[model samples]
Target: GESVGLHLPTLSVQEGDNSIINCAYSNSASDYFIWYKQESGKGPQFIIDIRSNMDKRQGQRVTVLLNKTVKHLSLQIAATQPGDSAVYFCAEKGDAGNMLTFGGGTRLMVKP
Candidate 1:
């Protein structure tokens, strides 16, 4: 079994600043990783993803980076807004199958 965990339980950022959230995974064999954002009551929403073969991936306002050497993952958000305030999680899927192991989550607060 694999486990994922965030370095910080909470992250605070100003409305127009860039934010970085980090996570660590226990499984060195995990080949796929994803970042998700969950609002106050809704389910987790897909943000971005990166595979073990790739070091970095970019989305609209987000970037996902994978450091297989350290079994670490990170999500970077540019010009973060209040709408970005939510709980963020990193999930990993290994060769074992489709099941994804998710991290506890980091609460991101975008201040005005």
Candidate 2:
């Protein structure tokens, strides 16, 4: 099969520091937004999510911020750890379908 997409870009930061990962979504009609983390050789794991109507959502040691006006989204990780190192992607889905469109991932590198 053909390649589904490109590899994730990388973000390097020190462990115990805060990290911010940013993404820009394509579809304005997209109402649901989710953040996922994919470790090496593993599938994407759900992190956090936000609705189009809302601006922000938070999870354990992670926070998702949405800016619908700019079609921008960001994920913040507090006290970053080595285990938190992974490729992170932002996905969105609309009310019309169950399918999700994923943005290119940003790989997080937590250096201890």
Candidate 3:
């Protein structure tokens, strides 16, 4: 069996500091990746995304980096806020793209 998941189950950061969440995927054929932020009692929200063809992509306050060589992915959040505290998930899709395989998720706790 293969696994596609977060490397850490939790991450704690100061409100003004930056945060980095990591993920690993077993399927090398996966060509698309997405990072999602889920706050308490809400659905997952799209944070950022990266393609296998590109190593990195950025959004408002988020960045997604992918390393196909190691099947690794990371999400970087700038100036983490209490509002940013949530469970973050990394997902991958093969050529089909929309059919996603998700990571276990890393809970980001921003301590003010």
Candidate 4:
């Protein structure tokens, strides 16, 4: 059975610093990846995404990296801000159409 998980349960960063969150997935067949940010009491919001065909992709202040060799993925957030504090999750969608498998979220806390 394939699954996704985060390397850390929480990450704390100073405001304006960069943040990096890591994740690992056991599913080799997955082709699409998405990063999501969920504030308390809110649904996950799309942050950035990368495809298996790409090693890296950047959007606004966020970047997503995919490493197929190790089945790993990472999300990088630049210039962390208080508004960026949230629970972040990485999800993968494979050949199974729209079905997505999400990893347990890692809480991101930005300090002033």
Candidate 5:
């Protein structure tokens, strides 16, 4: 359910523009939400996180909005750049081991 494929695998944007990536999760009991950016061949890097108690959280040049009502989440990237090109994954904390269940990844393509 939370493992659905992304709407678009690759998003192309010009440098200095903003980009938005979307994801949907099925588990409502998920307490913690995290956004990660994975460059080619690299592991996912933590961008920001928010608890179920909060609806929105922000980080440097990034913002995450959580809508528990609809079981949806989104990531906003400011000032898109070629260096920012990577695959983004949204992960929800599982009930058992504090491990994360990752969503289908979205690849961002920033054109210079």
Candidate 6:
């Protein structure tokens, strides 16, 4: 079975600093990848996405890098802020369905 897991459950960083979140996927057949950000109790919001054909994708202050060789994915966030403190999840669209297979989830803690 394919599953996504985070390297860390929580990450603490100072405002204005950069953050990097890592994730691993179990399925190599996954073609589409997506990174999402979730607030305290809200649903996940789309951040950035990348396809298996590409290695990297960038969005506003955010970047998603995928490594098919190791079945790994990473998210980079620049200029961390208080408002950026939230949970991040990595999702992949495998053979299951159009829905995404989510990671274990990582909590981003921003220090003022």
Alpha carbon lDDT of each predicted model: 0.89, 0.88, 0.86, 0.89, 0.88, 0.89
lDDT of 5 by residue, 1-112 (tens): 3456547488889999999999898688999999989998898899999999999988889999999999999999999888899999999985668778889888899988
Model 5 scores worst on lDDT over the 10 consecutive residues at 1-10
Candidate 4 per-residue lDDT over residues 4-104, each given as its tens digit: 45354889999999999998876899999999999999999988989899999999998899999999999999999999999998998887778988888
- TM-score for each candidate, following the candidate numbering: 0.92, 0.92, 0.89, 0.91, 0.89, 0.89
Error of 3 at 72 (Å): 0.4
Which one wins by TM-score: 4 or 5?
A: 4
Clashes of 1: 0
Residue 105 lDDT (model 6): 85
Q: After superposition, how far is residue 12 of candidate 4 from its true place, in Å?
A: 0.6
The C-alpha stretches of model 1 lying farther than 4 A from their native spots are: 1-8
Model 6: residue 53 alpha-carbon error in angstroms: 0.7
Kindly list the per-residue Cα lDDT of model 3 for residues 66-85, writing each as its tens digit. Answer: 88899999999999889999
Evaluate model 3: give its TM-score.
0.89
Q: In angstroms, how far off is 75's CA in candidate 3? A: 0.2
RMSD of model 6, in Å? 2.7
Name the better of 2 and 6 by lDDT: 6
Global fold similarity of model 2 (TM-score): 0.92
Q: Write the per-residue lDDT of candidate 6 for residues 9-108, one digit (tens) a residue.
A: 7999999999999999878999999888999889899889999999998888999999999999999999999999999889889977787788888899
Q: CA shift at 32, candidate 4, in angstroms?
A: 0.1
Poorest stretch of ten by lDDT in candidate 2: 1-10
